[model samples]
Target: MPDLLVEHHGVQVLVCSADGATIATEQDALDHLVGAAFQGAELVAVPAGRFDDRFYDLSSGVAGAILQKLANYRVRLAVVGDISHHMGTGTALRDLVREANRGRDIWFVTDLNELTTRLAPRP
Candidate 1:
């Protein structure tokens, strides 16, 4: 079974299944998110490495599944890396990611400190 890792991003940032592969099925992804999203941790980082290598490329269904799961939670997600490489490949995918990012709920940031400001507690 895969394990979840709570990392220190100057604050608590739970990273789910660091060594786990990209979710094989939609159900598996959703179930995992249910347990992974809320760790009582203030910040949650979704490392591309946690998912499939293709996550950057996002050619597989895992990408969409992950996004859908995040939306269900109505919670924000922080991606701790640069996605220019993948986004550069296709206009559609780039647009999709860019649009998704436009919403404050999803962030693709290179630094973790930025998370604190973006994910501040609602009250």
Candidate 2:
């Protein structure tokens, strides 16, 4: 089971999972992540260790479901923690994600501070 943490910033973040096991499937992962989002969470931090670039494509139903949920709620999504091991290495995606890291939309961050800073109310 994934542990979801509701923070003072009005964003509920899911960190680590029960049994330290990586979720077995994309379907289950999306269900867990989206459920957490519906819980009044504005942002979600899922470790990259659990999912790969296979999770990045919208063509994948599981990924599509997550993107749809993020768009529907206008919530910012952040997957914190190192994904390099899970994804090997790639600056292109890193740049792509960095560009999307902030806006009125979703963000995939590698650091917790970056996530908190992004979630802050803008003036």
- Choose the strongest candidate by TM-score: 1
Q: Candidate 2 overall Cα lDDT vs. reference?
A: 0.59
Q: After superposition, how far is residue 83 of candidate 1 from its true place, in Å?
A: 2.5
Each candidate structure's TM-score, on Cα atoms with residue i matched to residue i, is: 0.63, 0.62
lDDT of 2 by residue, 10-81 (tens): 656655453443533545555666566667666666666655455654344555555665566565666766
**How do the residues 21-119 of candidate 1 rate in per-residue lDDT, one tens digit apiece?**
555555655556545666564445765555555555556756677777767866456776666666767786777767866776667776556555655
RMSD (Å) of each candidate, 1 decimal? 4.5, 4.0
Q: What is each predicted model's overall lDDT from 0 to 1?
A: 0.60, 0.59
